[model samples]
Target: MCDWNVDPEPSKEKKGRLARARGNLARRHSERLLAELYAGGTLRARRDASAVLAFAVALVVHALTLAVTAGGIWFIVRGWGGWGMVPGALLLALGWSLRPRFRQLPKDTPVLRRAEAPELFALVDEVAGTRGVDTIVVNDWINAGVGSYGVRGRRLLVLGLPLWEILSPQQRIALLGHEMGHYVNGDTRHGLVVAAAYRSLITWHYYFEPGEHDPLDEAATLQLIVDLLYVVPRLLVLGVLTLLDRLSMRASQRAEYLADRVAAQAASTRAALEWMDRMLILDSAAVTLGREVNRTSLNRPRGKQQTDAWAKGLWERLAADLASVPEREHERLRRVGALRAHSVDSTHPPTHLRHACLQIGEATPPAVVIDDERDRRIAEELADARTKVALQILQDGY
Candidate 1:
């Protein structure tokens, strides 16, 4: 039977080779920059006045957008003819859409208040130093982050319960120290001007990005014209993005290194090292957790699914799964990270470089410690949310 309806997808490995080049370049750049900074024997990066160029470019982007927006208004007002209004409307729509937007915490994220988790807040306040955290939130994932959100730039802390459950108390403090470090270190990539400019270029690139189109489709010749028109603009947007990235990224990577230093200082060298070890096994941990959940769900009746002990025992099983991974596997993971200069994302430097940098520095004792009594008390505060998250994970089939 001939399957004329089927079109086998292109090989991902083949496509990835070409498509991943840009990311590969960025990673190499990160490695080089980290090496250079470390060679200077300084953990902290001094402010670079040259960052003003990035800010200037950002202003230019905003000015261009405003000019286009004004031109759109002029076109509509003059209305060269009745149908002349069409181009005006299109231009207006595009210019307006390209404007930067304020970030807000996701609606699905569960927000925790100080009253609800005072002990958790105390730990956060101590680690954060000045205590500007506006809200704390939790989710089911195995990651955590801190970010500014809302018009006033209120700080939001995201705690991933799965990862939190696996971490020791000091490791938890280390994690908090790292995130708070981003803010205190003053990572310039997140600054309003450069960040907004970068955002505009990304949007522009998306609008002009080329894609496969059928020649036999309606108005195919017009589509070809459109594709041709997109090429130059798309290239320009890409070039600008590259420029902005080059200007802002060095500072960002330095921030990451500095944050690691802060983590070590706050939670002790041992705790920070253990924290890094956990990072290396994140992929394996996620896979094991997923397998466990799937196995638990298998052949279990929907009605009786609620009777499952997910809330009571999922974390224990997950921790055991991670603990069982061989030390040789951990070494292998480190080698892989070193080979590729692995990072959590384009925004971070290579994780292995970070870990190695910490090892060579002086060992420090933890400034803050969470004792058994306090740890248990914090857990008591988290009991309701913990059970709810576990039930939700089970019901939602994660």
Candidate 2:
């Protein structure tokens, strides 16, 4: 009377249409939210939503873990020698093993001080304004950010020295203003909680893996049972993690937009746009240049000075190449779009989109100017510190 079988697949065109519709919907939703946020008075709501979601996820995870542990204990007490006890004991052990560990903030990079680089320190102070920065560190990479560190919870402003070398004085000020904006907006506080939750989910997922053997190695029936037991639970946990991660990422992107607006106010909108564009170009070039440097560095045993010189030369060449690109070619480059596309998991918007937003904001003068004398002084301040940092990099063979 009734058909039990059903079609298991959809047409490819149907699937494509559904995917496009979903993409359009999501894009429209994000645009509306961004518009409201930029118009003002929505950041608090976004922050609250992020916090509540993070808290809810944490609560559910902990409650599930506790319930499993309690059930395990009950089985152990009621039937100590039975098969029920075995699973109960295993569940308890799993819960215990997967408990989140206190994470340590990494501290391998060199810390720069006001005494060592007064000019740079003065520049930082001017950019930072009233913000409190506990430490200033130089990293070897081509990105910069602000974050809290260690048990003492010191606020750190980490500058990528290489990126610093590439940017003009005004661009550097725009970058610093953007980073300080994170502190001003209380993003770092919310960020810590979200980061902890993400780390916990990641840890749980890792614990769900079948260790040292494939479930398929067993007989078909046993393998089926194992798959039903392990695979299903893993997928459920992964789904929850994906949902929570996207929520956190959306909050982060909002924070980035707000920070960009702050940069537009504190520094020049034009400088902010220029900084982002230069960063996009540098990021693309860094990958190829980094690979070449890595290969070349490994082939020879060189002193710190020599290594530094080689790295500087490579950077200079990369900069030269960027500068030599024609204006028309630069326009073509934008057609490829930003280095990273806007996505659910991405923390930053696309460069073009950021530029568009800044264009709508009121214009401001450049926050800082670098004359030849000022540039020379800044260079001198970094000279010794750069050598030391270079030596460290060479010693680490990176």
Cα-based TM-score, every candidate: 0.87, 0.72
Error of 2 at 61 (Å): 4.3
Q: Write model 2 residue lDDT over 1-398, tens digit each, in one string.
A: 32222223322333343234334444444465568747863443245576577667766776766777787788788888878789888878876765544434456766766677777777666766764476778866677887777766668788876677677767887888888778766453245555655665667777666555454665666655665688877788778766665555455555666777667665688888777777656645565455555766666547766667765555455556567767655554454443323332233555666666666646877665557798789878777656555545445544
Residue 240: error of model 2 in Å?
Answer: 3.0
- Each prediction's RMSD over C-alphas, in Å, is 6.6, 9.1
Model 1, runs deviating above 4 Å: 1-29, 32-40, 215-219, 301-309
TM-score, candidate number 2: 0.72
lDDT of 1 by residue, 204-291 (tens): 8878876667878887778788989999988888777777777766777778888888898889989998898888878777787677
Residue 95's lDDT within candidate 1 is 87
TM-score of 1: 0.87
Model 1 C-alpha RMSD vs. true structure (Å) is: 6.6
